[model samples]
Target chain A: MDNKVHLITEQDIHAYIDGELSGERKAAVEVFLAERDLPLERAARYLRNNFDLKAVRDEVYRDEKLKSEIDRLLARRKPRRHLIGASA
Target chain B: MTNQANTISTEDLNACLPALYRFAYTLTRNDDRASDLVQDCVERCLRKQHLFDGQNLRSWMFTVCRRVFLNQIRRDKVRGVAVDMEDAPQSKLSISAFQEEKMHYQDVVESFRELPHNDKVVLSLVAIEGLKYEEAAELLEVPVGTVRSRLSRARSRLRDLLENSGEEGTVVAASV
Candidate 1:
């Protein structure tokens, strides 16, 4: 994150998005990013991808219809090889 | 049955269902296909229960899911499934009014499916699935550095993809 002397590298961007950068270093990265538009958007989106994906996944899991469908499939699918638990 | 429980029961399989389906979805990028792949993987696990080392059921299930996906891909190729455009998504995704966030979820996940298989695997495991770098590396049988590097590259590539597709998305927010 020490971009004070050198240009912002991909490593700094990674740390910033992961929230590993802090204090002055974090601010410096922000300063470098604020001057640009696309890079900032990309960085923000990258950070949010983690959050967005988790939110979407939670939404999927919370869907009662999908859950019921999967449950029905499980109940209906005959265990042609249902020997594991029985043998054990 | 010790803590490892060499025999994987229906209860164990049930507990692992969500995680397995999630992993399968990351690979197949289709709901029904992912579900079918999970079922196939479950069958393989049950049939090969003696092969289960009895440690980390989720991890083992993930491995099985990935193998099943590969096998399906091979089968599809042999069966002459429709060839997909290298960079073209299977469906047109656009941003519509009042559902920006919902559309965005499809946008992101759809773009994710377009990424190289390795990138999708690494990013899903670490970012979406919440595996540590070492754990992902071990699961993937790659070095920790490789995982970190692939994750970085994957993050950038995913961003690029979303950016590329977002431009095509219809901006219908003004009416709202």
Candidate 2:
């Protein structure tokens, strides 16, 4: 809770939150983020807006036509997996 | 021999049309050309279905579509056709001014389009298609490091574009 601005860089914050940092580096980033003015909510927001792929997920799933088309194509290529009853 | 192969390949083409068309659109940025390119790829894929294995069908179709488009670009250099817009239908462009200004989404799309084809492909594979770097690397026949670098640059470029498009600090944070 020291009011001093955190020495940790934004990249450190990102890496720490994303579990990219490890051991002492991870602990140091956590402490620094806690001390800095950047709140937990802000940190969460930063990760979401910058790192999440939700936007693209929506984009890909938006058009029913596209999904159906892709599924159709994939179904066509599906190999006949013979599992049971070979002589049926 | 030909009939069974043709039927199977036609089904494959029908199923893969959306992804193929979208991939083509991503490459060319022009809907009609994308459609034509995808059609050409489907035809080629149908003809060559014997070469395809059942694994990674999406990746195979994407590879074929991309190669076909590039091939057309090569051929068009020698025998140019009229670039008419009336006959072929266009993509459903999400480029409304209000929408663009409101969310800067159109700005992002344009910035993506402005990037080099390789960059665009890398970005779309990661950002849009949600493929892991390894998967994307396999699809693009590039190293995983290459995909990561491309994605980093593409994300930085997108941020720059959004900032420049007068939508700084307005990025909607994901809730989940």
Worst 10 residues of 2 chain B by lDDT: B80-89
DockQ in order: 0.07, 0.03
Every candidate's lDDT = 0.60, 0.49
Q: Is the docking of candidate 1 incorrect, acceptable, medium or high quality?
A: incorrect
Q: For residues B1-176, could you state the per-residue lDDT of candidate 2 as single tens digits?
A: 43453234456557766655655654444455566787788778778777765533445566566467546644542342212223123322223322322244345545545555555555555545545455566666678767666765655565565457765434222100
**Model 1 agreement with the true structure over B1-176: per-residue lDDT tens digits:** 45556688788789878756655654443455567888899999989887876655665665566567657656654543322333123322122222343556678767776777678667666665655565566666789778778989988888788778763334323213
Which candidate leads in TM-score? 1
Question: In angstroms, how far off is A2's CA in candidate 1?
Answer: 10
Give the range of the ten consecutive residues with the poorest summed lDDT in model 1 chain A. Answer: A79-88
Error of 2 at B95 (Å): 19
**Tens-digit lDDT track for model 1 on A1-88?**
2325637776676666554566666656665654444565455456557755554554443545544543443344333354334321
Per prediction, the TM-score for chain B is 0.53, 0.46
